[model samples]
Each structure stands twice: as structure tokens, then as C-alpha cells.
Target: MSDRALIPLLSAIALTAIIAACLVGSTTMSPGRLLAAMVGAGGAGDAIVLWEIRLPRAIAAFVVGAALGLCGAALQGLLRNPLAEPGVLGVSACASLGATLALFYGAAALSPIAVPVAAISGALAATALLAFAAIHTSSVITLILIGFGLSSFAGALMALLLNLAPNPFTLSDLISWTLGSVANRSFDDILLAAPFMIVGLVFIVLSRRALSALSLGEEAAHGLGVDLPRARGFVILGTGLVTGAAVSIAGAIGFIGIMAPHLVRPLVGYDPARTLAPSAILGGVILVLADIGVRLIPSPAELRLGVVAALIGAPAFVWIAIGRGRTHG
Candidate 1:
């Protein structure tokens, strides 16, 4: 790798290692026992804590983060807008509302698949709306405006549902999920999301060449034999799948979709293909660190991971807007 790429690659690995250490340290298992448990040589409780609890949560974090990263990258590529993200598309909001509605109607408790299925359906619905809007107006600003309107509608619907729900606990649970916390996510959550994540990643990984080709401009990409419709379709489907699955588990953890790709794009010399893996790794690390920070600073109450991300993301967003203003001026 070039020096530029080497640094991010090393940084990604280091962040991963630090996150692994933090996870082990934070849990009941000691460093030595956690190491032993990894090799299947620990006591039953240590093994259970390491394997059953921490391992799944860590894996879930990675998968969820990776999904967000890849989905964001794909959306940006498809939209030809650096600011495009799963969140901006209103897919995350739609999924959040879907999960909330499920909880409100007691469907989530009725079946294990209800939440994921509903969330995915909601994301697809948002994607469909975007597509319909795109047909009418191809402008990026218009697309974003429509997405914002959809998100607002979804958020309002969610609040209404929560208010009308008979059970207060259900409303609270739904609200907490909307705030986005990874605490107590089980192996079942991992299982439910894994297939979607994998399939989504595979599609996105294959689309890297298409993304890079499109960077030359859609007309040029078409002239060079790139199939525009197929490429855009893949991006939309892959992003929807990954983001939907992530929302199903983590409940609309926003900003990582925007942050991860932006953070790594410079290191890759703006190459979307190279940025992909680094973004995924960094996304996982950032969220894990954010989660760790949430636990440490907030103490026993535990901070919401989405809140932490937004705290970081909102400032970065302001900086971006200011930078754009300076450039335009």
C-alpha cells in the first residue's frame, strides 16, 4: 500500500485491537481469562461471559458498523453526493417507525422475525419513495428534501403510535430503541442480522468497480459500458438491506453512515473501492469506542450510543457546511 493508505490500514487494525482489549476489560472476565476463553480453555462462567455475552455484542457492533459504513458508501456513490447516507435517505427513520409500530401493536413479542421483517419492509418503502421522487426530479437537493419530509412524517407517526399504545413499557422500549442502544442485544439479534449483512456486503463489494467507474460521470460510465440502471439498483438494494438489518437490531444508529466514509475517503485518495474496507473497520472501532465512552462517562445509567455519535457527527456536519460555504464564496 502507498504511505497514505498504509496509515489508515494500520489505524484500522490498531483501533480494532484497542476495541477488543476494551471489551475484555469492561466485562467480568480478566485479560488472562478472556484470552483463555477465546481458546476454549477457561472456566464455565468466564467462557460464558466471553463467548455468550461479550463476543456476540462485539460481533454485533462490527456487523452493524460495517453495514452502516458500506451502505453509506454505496449511497454516496449512487447519489454522487458526499453527503448522501442511509439516514439522509430516511430509510433509518422508516425502519425505526416500523420497529416502533411492531412494538406498539405487540407484534415484536409475538414472533422473533417481526422486528427485522418490519424494519426491512419499512426501509424498502422509503427506498421506493426515493425512487419515485428521483423519477420526478433528479436533483440531489430535491432528493434530500423529499427524504427529510419522509423522515419527518415517519418520526411523527412513531410519536403518535407511542402515545396511543396501551402499554407504557412498550412505549418506553420503543423510544429507547429509537434512541439507539446496543446494550443487551442477544445472539438471536446477531443471527437475525447476519444473513442480510453478508448479502449486502457482497453486493456492495462487487459494486466497487461500478462506483469507481461512475466517478468519471454517469455519461462517461455509460460510454465505457457500465450499466447505469443495474449499478444504481445494486447500490439501492445493498444499502437498503444492510441499513435495514442494522436498524432492526440497533434501532437507527445514525451518522456512522456519514462519518465512516468521510473519515476514510482521504486516506484512499478518494478511491471508493479502497475506502470501503477501511470505512467498515473504522466504523466498528468508532462505535465500540463510543459505546465504551458511553459506559465510562455516564457510569451506571449508560449513555445512548446514537447520542454519542450525534454529538460527534453534528459538529462535523457544521464544519462541513462551513467548509462548503467558504469554497462557494
Candidate 2:
């Protein structure tokens, strides 16, 4: 389908997913009641449930998912690698490491803002390292290897922190946070992350044309007057902001960044620039649906959103790897 046609369809699907998410919690709510509650016309109890709990949680899912999707598309286009993702690139891992440090040292307890700020700092640091590595080498394989090293290092750091936890409670909290979820998130979390997400998204959007030029090859992109360094800066900064902010609140949700772009690429005719919006929308849809499924599944305790995402994402990652291997072979 054309981009024009697909936008409406994707928007409709995203809206439907959001509405479904709002209605599928433990206390099932009808659409009319949900709407009335949102508009402040429902019963006090329903109003609280709808406005205070479900609404914020659902919005968080959408926003985080959108950030992941956009970052994934931007990275894929920037690196020209199908396997590039925040988690795979160690960006999310680094962010997790930063948050883990905050939690371990009790900085997070001191202030709600500390964790997110630390996470964003880690993400930006990782992105800067990646960009620096890219500057010295044009090889995709080298960049991927660097990302692998970064991810491994971050993972090791987190594991060390877990081993040194002062108590089992701290260990459990760290583990749960790394497992990722938007459950019980408030508008406060959303408000905290929104500015970073928005700024990062704008940076990515501004580089669309540059991404399109780079898709043709560096020499050609240069010939077409694309400032390669500036483009890289935008992508790196944007990815850091979006991925870091997302990890701060959501705690390392994976694969949406990788999977969302791939899912919508064909729909957008495989144009890198065109893939951004659809990927973001589809990412939001996927997360909202996943969050709803986590709630609906029969369990004494709700499933973590990150676990659900990894369950789905891991298989997809394997499939993509296999497909790429076959194509290359």
C-alpha cells in the first residue's frame, strides 16, 4: 500500500489497540464507561481506575513503544544493518546498568529523577562510543562487534551489581526492573520522559533526508551534499535520548526497536525514511497489545511486559538471523 493509504490504516489499528488496552485490565471496563471516565462523567471508582491507572499505563506503553520503534528504524537506516537494535547495540544494556547503579546505591530512593537521568546518561555515553567507533571504521561487521562488546560489558556490570546487592529485596527489585514493565506507572513517569523522547524524535525526523541519501552509499551521499558527521550526530544523539528515556521508565523492553521496523518496511516499500512513522505506530500497537496480553493471561502475578516482549522478540531475532544468513550464503 502507498504511504498515504497506510497511515490511516495504521492509525486506526493503533487507536483500536489503545482502546482495547484500556478495557482489558483486571476490572474489565466497557468502552462507553471508559470514555465517560476519561471525560470525567463516570462514577468515582471508575474515574480513578480509568484516569489514574489504566490511562497512564496505556500511554506509557504507547510512548515507550514509539520511542523504541523510531530508534530502531533510525539505527537500521543509519547503520544499514538489519540486526541493529538498542539492546543488541548495548544502548539499553548500558541504560539498565546505569539504572541498576542508581538503585543499588540508593540514589533512586533519594529522588525519583535520579534513575531516569542516569539511564539517559548511560545511553548517550554508549551512543557516543558507538559513533566514535564508526568514525574510525566503515565496516558494518566492526561496528556490530563493538556493539557486542559493549552489550557484554554492560551485562557483566549489571550481573556484578546483582551479586553484590545488600539484600534479597534489592536483588529482586533489580531483577524485576530489568525484566521491564509499565504496570502502575503514573503520569509523572510519562511527563518525565516526554521531553527527551520528543527532542530525540525531532532530531531523527530532521535527519530523514540525510538517511535517504546515505542509503545510496557514503560516497554518493557525500556527492549529494549530505554532511555525514552531522547526520551521524543526529542519529546518535536521537537514539540516545529516545532509548535512554525509554529504558529509564520501562526498564529495558527489547526487540520492538528491531522488530517494529522490519514488520513495517515492506508496507512502506522499504524506503528507510518512510518507515519511521509506520514503525512508530506499529511499535505502539504491539506494546499496547502485549501489555494487555500480560494482564489477561492466567497467572497469580501478572507477567512482566519485558518478558512477553523478549519471548516474542527472541524467536523473531533468530528468524531474521537465519534469513540473513541464507541470503548471504
- Tell me the TM-score of each prediction against the true structure: 0.90, 0.95
lDDT of 1: 0.76
lDDT of 2 by residue, 161-218 (tens): 8889889999987897688999989999989888888899999999998988888987
Estimate every model's Cα lDDT from 0 to 1: 0.76, 0.89
Q: Choose the strongest candidate by TM-score.
A: 2
How many collisions between residues are there in candidate 2? 0
- Best lDDT among the predictions, by candidate number: 2
